[model samples]
Target: MLEVCVESVAGIGAAVAGGADRIELCAALAVGGLTPPLSLIRQAASAPIATHLLARPRDGNFRYGAGDAALVAQDITTAAEAGLAGVVIGASDASGRLDADMLAGWVAHARAAGQARGRPLSLTLHRAFDLCPDLFEALETAVHLGFDRILTSGGQPRAADALDTLAALVARADGRIIILPGSGIDTSNVAAILRTGAQEVHASCRSPLGEASEAEQRFGFQNGAALQTDPAKVSALKAMVRRA
Candidate 1:
């Protein structure tokens, strides 16, 4: 399955049109993604593909505070109310270990929210797992916490770059939970990722934005370089995955 990471409504449209199996709805992909607006989550849930909302309240690090956890709970409730397929969530303590207590709370909140809607919501632990001190121990924790899936690059910046570790993690998972390899995945190397025995892969399928207008370039605080999902890229990736 191809899980396309989309930052905007345009990206959502492209992913759905291109046969993506699921959508990881987020914002500010350049900073490793953040929670998207409720309106975007609502719009994405209306689409045909399964939509998983990223629950990170902010960017920079996986270690979250008490207040951050509360915000995550709120987002989960909002996602459930919007009829989303699921939500992607993660948290860590200052020691870079999985915050089991916080994670359990968030999971319980997700479950309760889903029940209120009379449907179960899928739970995915995000790439924050990469920040854990021990990958094997963290995998066990995720399974214990009842996460249905985990999105990781095997602790590397790119899944292709961590083939050996990813394969090891997949073997270690042994069907207890899904190991979804992501980060820098594209048509060029998706076959290699699949060969690691991972059932799912993630990609942004982004194309570079065109040059900004002179006035906008002068006033805009953000770097002009931006990325958006390309439908053709997503389609080609799906075709390659099918062949694999």
Candidate 2:
């Protein structure tokens, strides 16, 4: 299965049209993604594909404060209300370890919220697992916390750059939980990535739309040109995954 990360409404349409198995709806992918607005969440959930909302309150570091934790909880609840299939969430401690307690609280809250709506929400530990001091330990922690999956790059910046670790993690996982390889994934390298025994993969499949207006750039509103999921890229990636 291919999980396409999309940041805008147009991206969502492209992902769906391109045959994405799932959509990880987020904003500011440049900053490693943040919680999208409630309106966008509702809009993405309306699509036919499964939608998983990123629950990070802000960008920067995965280590968050009490207020930030509160915000994450609220976003998970909001995703449940919006009828999302699931949410991508993660948090690390000061020592760069997976924050089990924090994750437990949010997962419980998300599950409870879903139960109230008569649907069970899926929980995916985001890439914060990549920042953990020990990937194996973190994986164990995630499993203990009842996460449905762990999105990681095997402690590397890109999955292709860490195929060995990714394979190791997959072996250790032993189907106990999904080890989703992401970051720097594309059709060119997805076949090799899938060869690592990853049942699912994630990619932005983004392409530069065009340069932002000079005025918009000058105002520091848009950094570079906008990026959107290229339907062709998505289609090609899906085809490659299916072939593998």
Candidate 3:
């Protein structure tokens, strides 16, 4: 499955147009991703493809405090109310171990909300798993937490650079959970990434949108680079996934 991470409504259209199997909805793609606005979530829920909200309160580290946890919980509720297919989330303690207590609360919250809506929301353990000291241990923790999948790059900066580790994760998962290889995935290297035996892959599928306006850059509206979801790239990547 081709899970395309998108930051805007236009991206939702592009993903659908390109036949993406799923959408990881978020905001602020430049600094990882942030919680998307309710407006976007509502619209994403209506997309033809399955849309999963990325319930990240902010960028930076995954060590969420009490307040941050509250924010993430609310986002989970919002996504459930919005009729999204699922939520993607993760948290870690200072020592880089999965924060089981914190994650359990969020999972329970999402489950309750989903039950209220008459549909069990799917759960995806985000790349925060990559921060763990031991990935295999972390995988077990996630499965025990009721996560349906884990989005990771084999603890590397990019999945393409860690094919062996990615394969190892797939072997270790043993079908108990999905090992979704993401980060730096595109048509150029998707075939190799698929060799890891991952049933699904995630990518931004972004193409250059030209330079930012001078005023936009000066005012901090635009960061170092400007990009947009490229439907063609998404289509190409989806084709690659099919061939694999």
Candidate 4:
């Protein structure tokens, strides 16, 4: 399946028009991704494609204290109540191991919330898996946590740069969970990334729109340039996945 990670409502339209199989909805894609507001989540719930909210409450490390964990739990519940297909989440310990206890609680919370809504919530372990000291062990932990998938780059900055490790992860997962390779993936290298045996791939599929207004930049409200999802890129990548 082809999953497009989008930061805006326009992106939802693009993903649907481009025939993407799923959407990983988030905000502030510049800092990786942050949890989207409920307004955006509600909009995504109406999307034609399956949509998963990236339930990250912050921009830094994946470690969560009580307040952070509480916010994440609320986001998961919000996504379920909003009728989105799933949630994407992750956590890690000081030693960079998967925080199994925290993750288990979050999974349970998501499941219970989904049950209350009469729909099962899909769970995706996010890239924090790449931060683990042992990725294979981390994969096992995610499986035990009842995650439907783990999004990773084989512990590398780009999936294309870690084909062997990605393949290893797919092999290790062995259908118990999905190994979805993402990061630095585009039409140029998606073919190679998919050769690693991942059944699904994720990407931003974004192209430069333009810089923010001078005032927006002057006030530090804007960064370098702005970008938006490119439906053509999504279609091209999806076609490649089908061919592969």
Give per-residue CA lDDT, model 4, range 1-244, as digits (tens): 9999999999999999998999999999999899988888889999988999999999999989999999999999999889999999999999999999999999999999999999999999999999999999999999998999999999988888999999999999999999999999998999888888899999999998898999999999888789999999999999999999
Candidate 2 lDDT over residue span 1-244, tens digit each: 9999999999999999999999999999999898998889989988999999999888789988899999999998899889999999999999999988998999899889999999999899999999998999999999999999999998999999999999999999999999999999997789889988999999999999999999999999999889889999999999999999
Q: How many backbone overlaps does candidate 1 show?
A: 0
Tens digits of per-residue lDDT for model 1, 137-193: 999999999999999999988889999999999999999999999999999999999
All candidates' lDDT scores?
Answer: 0.93, 0.93, 0.94, 0.94
**How much lDDT does candidate 3 score?**
0.94
Which portions of model 4 miss their true places by more than 4 Å?
none
Worst 10-residue lDDT window for candidate 2 reads 56-65
lDDT of 3 by residue, 159-206 (tens): 999899999999999999999999999998999999989999999999
Model 1: CA > 4 A from native:
none
Show how many residue pairs clash in every candidate, following the order shown: 0, 0, 0, 0
TM-score for each model? 0.97, 0.98, 0.98, 0.98
Off by over 4 Å in 3: none
